[model samples]
Target: MLVGSPKVRMPPGPRGPAALNTLRLVQRPVESMIGWRRRYGDIFTVRLLVFGTGVYVSDLDEIKAMFTGDQSSLRAGEANAPLAPVLGSRSVLILDGPEHLRQRRLLLPPFQGSAVERFREVIAEVAEAEVARWSVGDRFRMRDRMRELTFEVIVRAVFGVTDPARIERLRSALVAVIDSQAVLLVPGALRRDLGGVGPWAAFQRRKRAADALLYEEIEHRRRDDDLGERSDVLSLLLRARDEDGRPLSDAELRDELMTLLLAGHETTATSLAFAFDLLPRHPRVLARLRDELAGGGADYLGAVVSETMRIRPVLDAAERTLTEPRTVCGWDLPAGIRVYPAILAVQHRPDLYPEPGRFRPERFLAEDPPPYAWIPFGGGIRRCIGAALAQAEMAEVIRTVVERVDLEPVRPEPEPVVIRGITMVPRHGTPVRVARITG
Candidate 1:
């Protein structure tokens, strides 16, 4: 399904087998990308395992151009078709142009700074309760703890599910689907159900269970007499009407809810895991953050979160396929080829952030990187809808954990990066031993 053009002037890249390039890229994405950027310079191309001819741009000027290109021509939804199986076709993640804009408008109100700020209390309460259960000297994976905390926040704030029994049931069902998603990334030839005996079949079963719980919640909320009085995301979305005074369909509601649950539950938790991994290894940075938290300052805490995201971004790149032939980053790109802003490569540019490999939250405190240079949440009109909410959750979780307890890395070296579903996560889950309970 790759869109190709005979007249296309493709950027220079490895002339070898696409499968081999994809194999190394899949095994070690960050290192492979860094090597490609060094070898091929600012802009280059790679043919994925199955996806064809992806051009990667790391320069700020080109990145800006690609992000701000003509909206109609840049078909991110088509490029994101792989997600449709899990997220559903109606999801905001897989829609393009006008339909995408419509979903964004209806969903934007609840994710605003003002709206997300309201969840701080809920996030904090969840954080405190979660850390409270952490034994003083026990070694544990911060990723595991963070996932539990994030999932509970989604259940309470996003779904407004308060009943202990119902929350547990919903959480269990959702995690089942999330855990088996690696089955979706393989070649189409290998994705068959095989009489309900394969990973795909198993994944389908989990997806159905999760969908049933979600649909139940949607219908149950629709019948609630006091829905209008609630401010939970699900409630607000339920009350939302488009310009035509039309409410979202049941499928729309379910897909959007699933998208949000996946974003907040996976991306934010993984970012926090990376933060925990970095802080214990960098004593100076850790000390400065503890001081800022102790003094009740906000700027440094915000900077810490920004630096964490910039250094080890969860999602690798924001993708789009061209519907028509268009010039991008000074290259005569053909329609159907995917163009990536190369989020990881751009952020690690040595010129943009001196000593890019170091974990220095102070750099963010002192100065801002160039606009296109530090895009972890992405840019343009298509930026991630949950950006503000994700950062707020990260801040509150980090604040609560640092204030209540001290953590020490279980290993001398920080955990290496590994792919988990779509996000880059700490390989060892950032194992740590709770050093002390300060608060």
Candidate 2:
């Protein structure tokens, strides 16, 4: 590809306050981005909700180049530093090089091998327990319910206890803190002048409280080294030792635990909510998927989850910075600029996916998608660490739900909204009604 100019014009699209354009996306990110794709080519620039410019890259080659670059060339941490306040400096999600690899290695076992297998039973049990709480013919917020269920599942699986009181309080506190959306680089003076300073202060206090409790858990586990009785991620992480034979420090363990808890629950909850909402609205697609799952059980359910991610992906994009000044997709880009591999946008491209908006589960079958064309967990070095574990949990939960309960969306359709402090969710909530699957 011939390299172009540093002054390359951003592909045509909406321009306004970062909040304005971003709110449009938050209201419906997938749709708005799709509209941009229709107008712009595979790549465009949006000066949206956060800080700085967001370059949306839907081209597979461009995405590959961005993710596979050397750290000095392209680093995830520097690109995602805005998340430092929420995820902490130690989180593996944003770390790079040796540190990133070290964290990922310590993080691998729990999500693989027999440890992950052990989670199957608990995941199904939790799904059953939550479904049991739902009444036939009664309307309820699906996102809210699933969010609670996911948090409880992680808490029990990681903490080895399902103390309802503690879990409830934690969930409420998390909701309060996460519900606030603070764009990176939004001036403190502007926020203060706008009278939003107090809420930001409160969010910080709540985040500290959450961290305090988590650290306490880490300390308690550190002091007690009886690992056999506990199968939780925390227990395993606490026992994890580096090549020098030292267990993870209190801070390292806390960081990993919080990362798993937050990342594990939020994405899964939003995905399930989207899948459930999309199912009934597209009866033909839903029927085919249900039939496939009914026939193949776990295998079919796995495919369904992958395909669901492609169609209605929970995450919009992941960011990376250019290492050296380079050209991508025939466009010249300078160093220090950011690249956003728009996951949903790439999955929706007509070139990659025919009838892109249609909910087609078959597209993810072994023979269907091109390499790197359909990434819900992402690809390359920076792929989601919990990908396998998440798939395992989702398979069990979806199977349990399909076998036990039949659900219908209470609303005409779901409206995905960015909850925005780190992740996104539906604006109000994805509400639905459930009835038992009859014999």
Candidate 3:
């Protein structure tokens, strides 16, 4: 039989409905959670709105273990089951052990090292082309436009689809699926357990349509038997083989592609949107960023992207379950209780960072941050396979934006950020005015 409460008193945490607090945290994750950390200290557990369980950790040592723990002991799939229906049963993000390792290896070559260098021009050209389309005096929702631009870059660079007509159709369906996922974030068993069947069914129907297009391309390449075809993530996956020397199944191919498309596109777009939103508010930081860009080039902007991700980190926290009973940050967490290392909470701790709320790229410049202090792309075996590619993509776009157009924050209230399912985005789309510096 399970114990009612631990023999020792649990770490102090917010009183009242834990689930409601968690819901609010998702709505205003960073600010409110940081406040909790301030009041409750580093490690605390709050029972989320009935049936939901959560442990929030800002303590560095505990966080390191949470991220770097043995995979079997801290499974993410069990904790994130709500995403499976949308991401698909075989999605790499939901897999574990040898399976996760195999998929990641198959996916890594296209995202990092020399493979990334191959796509630099494509990313830059796409960014430049999109920038040209923006009229000088137009007021655009920066969040939506940034998503469009990054989504196009991801489509072109990863799938090699540069045709305007086909790309627009793909963008539409992908946006529908992502937008549906935004509604599923509210924490409750009713929505979480059921998978929002009505809208989710609609989302999957569109996803199937998108998959037909992706798989057609996959099959077209397979039929050619041309291993030396032009490079893209699709081709890389097509050619990658497991130790058994078997190619990925069609379902596996579709799931991984969907994973990349969803994960690679939206998260990067959110980070870029957040970076742009933060730029105009901190004039000194923005001016310094421009100076750094002028002198250091794209790498300078890359650092800014890293800092933006660290501060507002697109995902508020990554969760894992303890396989065995263990003491973490003082409390004895029993087997199967979930632990959430608050990336935003840890990053904003003034104890760890000086003036943590302020945007400063220099933090990522020289020294590596303390482990778990920065995990925008996550860590350990479950680390994001596309980290390097996302960085390069963000760097290229920022450079292009700065070079071609000057963005000014319009007179409007700043939007609060919120968690929608797994990805964090501005609650109200970021609004801005653009002026052409060079047409």
Task: Give the number of the best model, judged by lDDT.
Answer: 1
Compared with the true structure, all predictions reach lDDT values of: 0.85, 0.72, 0.76
Candidate 3 lDDT score relative to the true structure? 0.76
Models 1 onward score TM values of 0.93, 0.86, 0.90
Once fitted onto the true fold, the runs of candidate 2 whose alpha carbons sit more than 4 angstroms away are 1-20, 163-201, 285-296, 366-368, 413-424, 435-439
Clashes of each: 1, 1, 3
Worst 10 residues of 3 by lDDT: 187-196
Better of 1 and 3 by TM-score: 1
Residues 183-290, model 1: lDDT tens digits: 768679877788998788888889999999999999999899989898899999999999999999999999999888876787888999999998878878778888
Clash pairs of candidate 1?
3-336
- Candidates 2 and 3, the one with greater lDDT: 3
Candidate 1 structure, TM-score to reference:
0.93
Worst 10 residues of 1 by lDDT: 1-10
Q: Which candidate has the top score in TM-score? A: 1
Deviation in Å, model 2, residue 266 alpha carbon? 1.5
